[model samples]
Target chain A: MASSKAQAGQTLWAKMPKANAELFALTYGSLVTELVRDYEDPIEVNAQLERIGHSIGVRCVDELLSKADSSNLGSAVTQCGNLRDTAEVVSKVGFRMFLGIQAEVGGYSQDQRSFSIYLQENPLSTFVELPTIGDEQSSSSPSGGLDDLRKLKYSNLYCGVIRGALEMVNLKVECTIVRDTLKGDELNEIRVELKEVLSDGAGDDYKEE
Target chain B: MTVHAIHIFDRKGKTLFTKRYTTTKQQLMQDAEQVSEQRKLIFGMLFSLRELVGSLTPEGGSPALQSVKTGAGTLHCYETISGLRIALYTNNNPVMNTLPGARAAGGESTSITSFQTALKYIYSEIWVECVVRSPLYRPEDIQVDPLEGRDNNAGRFDIKSTNFEVKLDAYLSSMPWFR
Candidate 1:
């Protein structure tokens, strides 16, 4: 009986190890691609890339500390309270490190009355490449191409890192990436907007939920 | 750490020219010798009478003898005679994202009639290293191969000049670095 339990534990560990490795690889690869597509100079690009990743690490460390509340873990283990905290930590650290950037705390819509953060930059703007084909010409225009691009699904690789790090903290929060035109510096602002979906208390509904 | 130079290669395996920094000092005597060799080779490859000299000059002293430094992270640029350009930059600065589409089109390639006007952009921004272009011919000519020889790499692409509408593959393939 003891050996059977041990075998089950080992199988569980083996099954998850590959998934975690794949996630790490994907996160690192995407981070590199995003950097390459955006920057021209390698030195500045590489330095900023590492700095951003480092900032993620630093914030993740703090999040782990608070969530785990284990003194023994010390600085050796990285943690976070949840995916939301992880995203918040990354965004905060990245802003502070680059462009001397910062975000302002604000309340949600006049009716919602929820809390949120707002990024501010004047010269900063998001970059969107216009398609070379026909009808796409107006895409470069402020309202035409650029606006549509802004609404496209944002791939927040940093948020993925935050999510992965927070998993270490045993915290999971569904995260979304939202873009705000108000944020400048062409900065790719990552908003960890959280959501909660309520479902009927049935096992069948739980799967759909 | 200080960066002394950046070497860039295009999709055609051609070496655009190396961007030599004339300001920073060479760290060791061995490194100084390497720079001297590179300088001689660059001087021999001069194509046009109006050589676009890119120099990083020190505030004082002869720029030629200044120290050239190498560090873990720094940006570098290399340009092809046919107007193909590649740059490698440190991954840390937020400004890196601003250079790809419009900012990189700094009028250098305006006169190159034969070259395609396709822009090839690539980077590992999280690590601060990347490459960008103004514009080029054929959208398909630009490729970002993975560091690993894996097929399932998500972000990597295989851009070729033949994939473009214009044909600058021969010119690009004949670059100094390609040899």
Candidate 2:
């Protein structure tokens, strides 16, 4: 299962139109900085970034589905059966196809309702670091020096993207950044918890004669 | 072989587009209300049938309903991962599977797979091009209740765009079994 999907992701990544990686990373960094400046509050900036990512995710899903099945055999629908499959698609196919990066899926909860995606290489954060306030940094060193860095999830946009994309496929999920490399964690991990499987809204009111 | 009709439904079981051919069997319904009622019945039946199929499958995977054959006709369905469903109604006695020698070698399954492939092509190539990628198309508008008795074109959405209609007709007509 893993090898086939990884191969599929690699092929798709190869087929996708190329973009400059540095330029892409810098653009995202600029956007986040602008958001921080505009929002002032770290929490608000994170929320705004997520909102932007959510809209992107909504559209991204269609593009992913269309491209994933280059064979166009309508097999894309049957690929992801449950939460496990969804995670594999998102981490393997989704990340590689879009970002040209491989994300590992691990840390699955016993119930199978939740899982974590670990990003060993986060392109968006390659050139980003939380700026510390002068003097306040020295005084607040004991209090975890950079309070904003603690609150601001620099790559929180990924959480929203995952949530929105899964929702489009009728899987309502909650994504939280459990660990961030920007915050000195070894890896960037996003925990996804399945909240519900939305009914297709095939209205029960419709009665067949 | 005769392609009788086609129906496209969104994930919400709302009919996005419907077209019927082969009216020789019966006159087309003149009443818009009657046509919509028929669409509703078809969607409801498909929804329940899918659930039934899902329950019967031991593996309990996604609801896989490839086709439903009745004395009248056969319904071939292909659902994208996004829940966009394309269903085609064709005559039960498909000419492609009737070759005497081919029947011994599982020709029926081959024909069904081919039909599904055709449906997928319609979706990924035609629908995605003319509708999903169209700048004027609005995905949000699909939520509006057509049963609310709004304008005649309210429920039609962007799928009825001239470009989509032309492309769909061309593709369907190109099929070997389309009559």
Candidate 3:
């Protein structure tokens, strides 16, 4: 309870009961929808959402770093160096701390272009229902809508955190949410690809400066 | 240590901005200049103080090390061209350890106090200070000073010792500038 209290004060999901995960997800979705509708500027909304995500990422990074005992041993140096290691830490630490889910780190590609983290179950995202307002009702049935929601891959929130934290380290990465991975599957897998454009250019300006 | 520069892009993958700051004032200034220019390419900047704090991570040494989630120092930065949003958040509050008092206050009874505490720390102390002081923002544009209200079910507790959620609806609703 003390740990929960301490963590609650710091994390985005603080005070969120286990029963309320679905509600929180729905609220999160609705908030995004509302922001998009009100702003009507994809750039602004996306940027704002990314900014929010970035902040969360920064906080999450702190949490991840603190939890790095010998049991979770993977070189911090390597984790700090490559995006793959960082992604592993993100999925592992993110699930353990926030979602109460244990995520498995999957294979890393040879070129290091892509890596995967698989969540056996996402309790936080389960049972989320996007409140259908006027006009959106008849277009899709609840089951179909739920399926669509289930297909929602990646927490832009976590993506923002990863992207932002990497930026703090001066690593330019292009993060994409792979929705296909979230489809009917036993495990919820997210594939994070490090953008080639920036990776190729890494350390170029820093060395010169 | 290798200093890596991260290029920030919009959702469309357009290179809207990039910045790299070292411990040196010269490098910080240069990075600030680059960020300023990029801000012009993007819209105005609207960021919380925490983002500014997070941006200071690359400067190196104990300052950067201490600044992580446990540091007491303030982080501040802004891109005027990016719509000039600034954030100032600290990971250095000892009050978080005293959740028993907060918890004893109870959810229903202490809801207002909890919300007030969160606002006091996050918005007023961290956010507003950064905004008012930033060169990017006009004082009059802020409109509401220290937006405050209560959060009913907003609270998070974990091993990390952080759980304070102040509803941003009033602040969001009041921000005529925020589209």
Could you say which candidate leads in DockQ?
Answer: 2
Point out where model 1 deviates above 4 Å.
A1-94, A97-100, A108-115, A122-150, A153-155, A182-209, B1-179
Docking class of 1: incorrect
Q: What is the TM-score of chain B in candidate 2?
A: 0.80
Number of the predicted model whose TM-score against the real structure is largest: 2
Residues A50-132 of candidate 3: C-alpha lDDT, one tens digit per residue: 66777655444433333332112223322344555466545654555567666666678888767776767765455544332
Could you give the interface RMSD of each candidate, to one decimal?
23.8, 2.3, 13.7
What is the DockQ of the complex in model 2? Answer: 0.38
Instruction: Output the worst ten-in-a-row residue range by lDDT, candidate 3 chain A.
Output: A69-78
How are the candidates ranked when ordered by lDDT, highest leading?
2, 3, 1
Q: What would the per-residue lDDT of candidate 1 be over residues A55-140, giving only the tens digit for each residue?
A: 35433333323222222221222222233333344334323332234544344334332234455541222342323335455632
Better of 2 and 3 by TM-score: 2
TM-score (all chains, Cα) for each model: 0.24, 0.80, 0.39
lDDT of 2 by residue, A36-146 (tens): 666667788789888877767876777778766544323432456678888988998889888989899988899999999999999889877765554454542333334
When summed lDDT is taken over every stretch of 10 residues in candidate 2 chain A, the lowest stretch is A137-146
Shift in Å, residue B117, candidate 1: 58
Task: Provide the lDDT at A183 for model 3.
Answer: 45
lDDT of 3 by residue, B1-179 (tens): 11222222222222322323224455556544465444433322322233454466564421111112324322232221112222222222323233434355434634223323332333333332343223343211221111112233123111112111122323422222112
Fnat of each prediction? Answer: 0.00, 0.45, 0.00
